[model samples]
Structures are given as C-alpha cells and as structure tokens.
Target: MPHIYAKYISKVLELPLKRDNFIVYDRFVNERAELFFVSQDGVDFALTLRRKNNRYLIKYDKATRPASTFILTKALSNLAIALECEVENSNLALVQKKESEVSPWLLKPNFFEKNPTFLDGKQAELEVGFGSGRHLSAIAQEFKEKIFFGIEIYKPAALQLLGRIERENMPNIFVVDFDARLFLQTLPSDSLDKIHIHFPVPWNDSPHRRVFVKKFIDEAFRVLKPNGTLELRSDDEVYFKDACGLILEYKTSNFHVFKNRQILVSSKYEDRWKKQGKDIYDLIITAVKKQNDDKIECNFDFENAMDISIAEQICSLPAIVFDGIVVRFEDAFKSESGAFIIKIILGSVDMPESKYIYTRDGISSFYPTKPLPIRDNMIAFKKLKEKLYGKSN
Candidate 1:
C-alpha cells in the first residue's frame, strides 16, 4: 500500500497558473474526464466522469498498484510541469537581454562623412589598439595634413573616442573596429607612410615568439616604403632587449632606439602602469631596402665561416656564396687626404656569379672590415675534411 494524493481535472488547462491562485471551478469540468486520488495510508482511487444523456455520471475505482504509487506519480508529474515552465521563461529572458545590449560604436561610413570639412590629403598613418585615443588624437591634431586611422576592439573605448571625434569634428581620423595585426595584412604594400604600434599586447610568455617576431617584422618591412619608419613602444625591458636582438638578426641599416619614459605621448594604460612604478622601454626602427647593386661586406674567418653563412642566409636567402680570403698586394696606397692607406681586394674563385668579399677585421681602426669569400660549394668539402681528420691542420 502507498500514500494517496488528491488530483483535479479541468476542462481548459492554463499551463502556467497566475501569480497567487491554484484552484478550478466545478463548472470548468468537461465530459469524458478522469481524476485520480491516493491516501497517505497507501490506498489508490480514481474518479471518472462521463456524460450519459443530459447529466454527468461519476464512477470511482481503486488502482491495481498502491496509494504510494499515486503519490509518487503525482509529485513527479508536477515537478516535470514546473521544470518545463522554468526553462521556457529563462530562454525568453535571455533573448530579451541580448536584444537590448547593442554596441554603441556601430556606425556607417556615411555617418563619418556628415561633416565633410575635416577631410584633408595628409600622410595617412594608422595605430592599432588605440585605448583612450589620447595619443591618436594628439597626433591627429599635430599632423593635420596626415590622415590617422585607428582600430580598437573595445566597445566602450571605441564609443568614447567616436564621440570625441564627432564632437571635435576631427575629419582626418578614421576608426576601424578590428585587431591591428589582421588589419595590417589588408593594406597595400608601400601604401602607408608610417605605422606606430605603441605598447601593444606583448604575448610575453614566450620571448622568442612575440607578435612582433620575424614574420611580423618582415611584413612591416614589406608594406613600408624604402625608408618608412615603424615605431614600437613597450614597458617591458626584457621584451625590448629581445626585440633589439631580433632586429640585429634581421640586420637592417635604418634602425633607431628610443626610451618610452622620455616620450611624452604616453597612453592611458602606460600612465597607469607608470603609476605602479614600472620602467618603460621604447624602440623606433626604420627599414630601408638595399639598392640593386648594393654590396654587404663583412669579415669572416674559416673557424666562424659557418656562423657567417647562417647570418648571410638569414639576411638575404637568395644571395650567392663565394669562397676564398682577401689579401692586399701592397701594404699602403695613396689616399685623397695625401695619407698612405692599406689597399685590399679579396682574392677567391673567379666565378661568373656576382661576388662580395667578407672579412672579420679592417686594415686600420677607421676603415670598414670586409667579409671573407667562402663559396657555398666548398662547405661540403670543409665538413668532410673536418670529419676525417679533425679541424684544418
């Protein structure tokens, strides 16, 4: 025997009852209806109602199971109904919440052109992740002739800067909603006059694998003109040193280093970080393309020839390697200053390919050192001899 519970039957069911009440009237009962009830003493009973001619006939019967079965079934059925109602209500609320939360920075291009007086043909420059737009706004004002493009992903910050741009009627500035690295790939090569990336997210977990690694630098170098400048600013000293090392490895002639603490155009985040007493570092580097016939000369000894080969391969992969050492026929030659200076030319294999002599040191203190000529074909022979009978005897 099981416990019994009372049940009610309604003609029309309002699935979710109103806030305060949970009862139905007798008049609401309809034909061919059944109501089941169970008692706490483990008795089960059911009442069936049907229309005969004009009046309704009510028949009662006992359940084959027990009163406990009726009570458990009734509780489970009610729980199912409540859970369904809750799920539906929650889904509706979530949809409404999402609908109401629209970004304020969403705007059309025509919105920017509403006041067309600000459009000028200035040198176009772009800065990614312009947090508060303080540095961008300052640069826009300072270089009125240059069009400044800024991209930011943060909605509130973007909205704030959009309001400022509209209020000031700064026509030379354009804002894009995107990441800086992705936005850079879309621009035409050599189209930009300058690009400034100040205090960007330094993905510092791996020093060798920064956002501004060899690939990023190579892309920046490609997009820039023959002498366009790429400025990088950061507060991390370790990151700055790693960046300097990468730049040296790339071996560009037009490079300049700067101090972030000394620079006045500090970002809002930078200011906050400064308040925390973190020393900031900045490096400004420019990339210049080599001329068609420009020669790169360096000094190299046979002992360190492999290192020189790796460096050359890294700097310019398509370059041809030459073998031999440079020897001066005479100790000193006449100079334009009426002084006797050392005259030296590299003597190596006279192949048909264009050649550059590389040496480790210079003839005197002031003269530039030359690169030793070591042909690529001779590398295998050198390796074989070393393997057979140690280093060169």
Candidate 2:
C-alpha cells in the first residue's frame, strides 16, 4: 500500500529502460489511469500513476502485487527516484536506504517451473500457519534430517520466522508466504510425512474460507505418506468440531480427537488460553493407505486473440460457477501499445487465483504465469477457455 503523491507526471514517458532498481518493460493507458509493467528483484508487476485531486498518485496495481510489501516499497521508492518528481507523505525515504536483509529459507510460489519438485521427494513435514517460529523451529531442530515447510499468508509473520530461521541457521526449515490450502494442492501424493495445522483462524462467519474444508482435508490426506498424520490444534472449540465434521465426510475415518493435550511446544496464545481455562482441542487424522498420484494435466494456452467486444461482454456478466469452481473476468485495460491486460480471478470456490493476462499482436499468455496446476484450477482454466475462445480443438 505504499504510495506517493506528485505534482505532475509526464504524458510521453516510454518504457523498456532500466531505472535504478526497477526495469520498465511496458506501458498501458486508459481513461482511468496509466499503468506500467515493471520488474524489480525479479518480481514482475504493474505500477499505476493516475490523476487524483489535481495531483498524481502512484502505487502498485493491486491485482498484480507481489507477496512481499518490503520489495514493493523498495521498487516504488526507486521508481519515484527514477521519475524525478517531488512527492509528499511517502515512505520513499525509508526504502531509499540500503536493502534489508533477506533470508535464504524464504521461497516464492514456483510450483509451475517445468513441474519443479518441492523438497525433491524427500521425507518432509509441513506446518500450516506458523504464526511464530516456535513450533516449526523446534521441530526442525529436533528432526534435522527431515525438511520442514512452513506456510504462512501473513507477510510480517513469515518475515519474522524467516529471520529466526536465518539467525538460528536452520537450513532445514523453509517458509512460504502463501495460502496453505492452495499450497497443499501443489504437493505430490504420499510425499509428506506429517501435516500440522495449529491455531488456525476459525473463520466462523466465512466458513468457506476455513482451512479445514472438505477439499483441503482431501488434499491433506492425499499428500500424507502411509501411516502419516494430519494434526490440528486449536483453542476454538467451534473450529475443532467443524474440522471433525469435514474430516468425517471423507471415505476413511482413521482419526482421533483429544482435549487439552500437551505438545512439543506451546505458543504464547496457547499458554494464555490455558491460563484463561479454555479447553484446547486436537484432531489427528492418520493416512490409512497410500494414495494414487493422480496428477492433473492442463495448460493455459490461447490460440487466438479475443475480440474486444467479446472481452467486454464477458467482463460485464456475473461470475461463471460450475462444479465448485468460479471464473470471473474482473477488469480490462487497453495499453497504449495496442495490447490488452485482462485481470481475472478463477479457481476453486475456496481457493481462487487472481492474475493478469497480456494480449497483443502475436502475444497471448498469462502476465506473470498461469495458476498452480491443481485439479480445481485445471477445471476452472478449461471452463474459462471455453467461455473466451470457444471449446479447445
């Protein structure tokens, strides 16, 4: 959300040039704003500079932002420097200094790079939503041979745990800033030794957003090795019961429930909960047998450029929903270079992916890349393709 206010912006600026830490690759313009495809620290996204209250406000295009705000802030500051425009009420000064320390254990979501194998078939354990480094760090130190993957959606918590990993020199621990529900889908069947969900958000009001949905539990069971366990620890009894209900929906019911059970490590919240006399709940599901590695085969390829009128028509309709998947064309931007960038949100109802697609002369592909090759995503992709460019040949 870092932004700067400038008095004026040049209308005739071009791209494909290096500017400090940012590389301006392309520019797009519409009545609403002017957007530039920029890259910094190997992260590609769009930056927008638009008129507001007789002044210009520049910021990241929300649909294409990277996971780390620090990186975005740095890029924005460097961009301001490149623009050579005076700004007001900006953190541009703070990020102008030397770059902050980055951890070696942090990872971006690169699941689709030639079908790269995460952990390379090694015996691994996963901790979803590792708020602090306490549980994951402790387990990693205890089991040096087994790799530990920690998934967190919050940037600050992930950064903090990454710092702890670096400080403690725990090379076995890797942290990813992503949604655990989607991340689980990327893992291979029977690849993980254990999966842990500790202190997950209850999401009572938004049950669809809960991590223990039927599909997530199905994925967890799929990824667990034979005799492997998927454990859930929570201070909220409602969430615990909800998870139990969902797990029972599966074919196998090799699971157990515990109350006020002790673990290897206790988080500060757990300690406080115990002091307040709250009954902690635990649900452990055991993988009774190995699951088949049913890999989903699909691709996001466009053979022809879509007509402008068709694109506009599709964008005007409500979201297309089918078989637990939803595809929606959110917005469309026509670049100055006669290209179109269509912003889209599509995937499973519980875990959707948002990205931009660049369409121009002899060019039609996802902006950064395609969505993760999960079953739900694949279904959504095919459905979206049919809607846009007709049934595949």
Candidate 3:
C-alpha cells in the first residue's frame, strides 16, 4: 500500500473536491479516524487520515484497494498535491503516472467475465506466479506462434512484467493480476497447451496456500489439452515431494519428478539457487483425459435491503462456519452519516476474500462489486447471504 505523511493542519477540509482526474466523493468520520473515498477514473479507494502528535498519517484502506497500483499510485500522488500540505516522509512520492504509460498487456480480473475465448484458435500457454517475468518473457520471445499468459498476484511484480512486455514489444504475451488458482477455473476446458508453475511459494507454515493443491491440480488438468502438460519447477525439496505425492494420490499418476533439470529459460532465483548447490526439482503432469468446463454461477447482490438487526448480530459473531465456507466479521466502523462500514473475511478457506461491505439507508453492497466466482466462494456467498437476509424461496 502506498502512503504519505504530511504536516497536520488544524483546518477543515472541503468535500467533493476534484484534482487531476480524481474526485473525492464522500468523507466518512468516526471516533477512530476519518475516511475519504476517492475515485480515480472509474476505480475507487479510500484514503485514511489519522492524526498523530503533530502530523497526519495518510494511507490507503487496504480492503478497498484495486488490484493494480498504477492508477491508485497516481491518484494518491494527486491527492497529496491537492492537500497542499508540507510533506514529511513518504514512500509514494508526488509523481504523476500517465494513463498512456500503462501497458496494454496488463489485465484485471474482470477481463474474464466468463470462460474467456480471447485466445481464439491460437495455441495458448500459461505460467502461474511469474515472479520476475524472466522465464515468461524468454518463452514468449522463443515461442512467437503461441499466446502466453502470466498470472501474478504481487502488484510490483505484475507492474514490472508489464514494463518488460512494453519495453520488449511482446504483443503475444498477456499479464493478469489475479490468483492463478481461481484464474485457471475461469478458462475454457482443454484450451491451454501447457501450464507452468515455477518455484511457487512453499507455504511451509500453511500448506493450504500452496499452488500445487488437489483442487488446483484438477483445474489445471481440466484446462490443459489432451496430452498437454502441467509443469512444476521448484527449489524446495519438501514442496516438490509433497506435491508429487498429492498429485499421485489425488489425481492421475502420469507425472515425472526430475532433479536439477535445466529448461529452455531460467529465472534469476533459479540461477542463484543452482550456484548455492541447491537441487532444483521438476514435476511434469500430462493430462490423460479431457474434462468439461463447469461454469461458476453465483451473485453477491442482495434481493432486499439488509436488516440492521442481522447486521448487528453479524458484527458480534466470532465466526460462522458451514461446510467448506467460513465467514468472519473483523471490524465495524460508523460513518458520520447513518452508514455502517463493516470489514469481513469470508469465502473459501483456501483463498478467503477480505472486503468491506457498505450499508446505508438499508441498502448494502460489496465495495468492489463482488468476490471471485470460484465454487467455494460461491458457496460461502450463498451461506452468508442466507444468514444476513434469511433464506429466500
């Protein structure tokens, strides 16, 4: 999250302010702090202003931040300038980034409204969690005939890759800022020629966060064409062994495990690991059979206004767990207006979405429209809605 620290001025700030293609729509204040909802272009996020001893600490509301940071960074810079306050110290310097500077290769999650047919008839391949974009760029340059898709949740890495794509003029490569697990589920069945998972996070403390899980493997196989491969390269021996065992036990046993095998392209991290005498492992699983694409169907919209009593009760519950769904109400904030800003963590246990639900004048809605349309998330959405507004026949 980009933020800035400025001198605190004992003066009232006006609302509905506009500066540099950004508008501060509403201001919400409570005993704790104040929230200014700012919109840049069509994207929106909140700037939290907290008064310290003699300075104001301004930072982004993590729950409401958009996936890409390009627009948000520029908007924050403009807001800082509009305040006209003396800056103290900040990571987000007052630098404006032009919209034209944004790379066309970058994509938001909404780009996949349904099963994406953007690939047309071209041979499509994907690399999960492209950290440095080196391997992805190398392969895309080598395979000029195939369309390459790279998924990375890290904002900085995604932006860096976007810069590389533009600098190198790789029109065939596309970068998506999203969870690879959910992204795979949104692709048409048997559409991808190959899926690459190179040096994914080990998640030793929490194995559930790893990319080589059973559900993810199932989705990978589903999206891969017949005889197409799902390749996994890692430097973590434990992760490699566990992933191999899981794949062998849960899915088809048609997979191979290699040690220190070199590929066509290598990432810098891989080079460092090899220099340190680290053994690199590779697991290549070939899809044995084709599977049908299952459309994810669910909506986060409420049929009626939210009941205040139900909302209040939800604010008190530690957590609501049903089957594979878990909903936890984290915090509650009251606005100057008669509105409730409730922060919650709900959805699939593996990849729960943390978001804010805004409620005012009886109407309630998710700040960012909706959560990812994964099956577990859909289940959790239904259960949460039922608990909030009661079951609808």
Q: After superposition on all CA atoms, what RMSD does each candidate show versus the true structure? A: 32.0, 2.3, 3.1
Give the per-residue lDDT digits (tens) of candidate 1, residues 208-246: 435577656765776566677788888877778888888
Which segments of candidate 1 are over 4 A away from where they belong?
A: 1-122, 206-209, 290-393
Ranking by lDDT: 2, 3, 1
Pairs that collide in candidate 2 are none
What C-alpha lDDT do the candidate models reach, one value each? Answer: 0.47, 0.80, 0.78
Residue-level lDDT for 165 in candidate 1: 77
User: Over the stretch 290-381, how does candidate 3's per-residue lDDT look in tens digits?
Assistant: 44555657877867666556666778887878775788887676655567777788876766788777887788888755777667777777
User: Candidate 2 on 235-294: residue-level lDDT in tens?
Assistant: 988888888988777676889999999988888878889999999999999975633556
lDDT of 2 at 255: 90
Superposed model 2: Cα runs more than 4 Å off: 96-102, 112-115, 118-121, 288-294
TM per candidate comes to 0.44, 0.92, 0.86
Summing lDDT over every window of 10 consecutive residues in candidate 1, give the lowest-scoring window. 21-30
The candidate with the higher lDDT, 2 or 3, is 2
Better of 1 and 2 by lDDT: 2
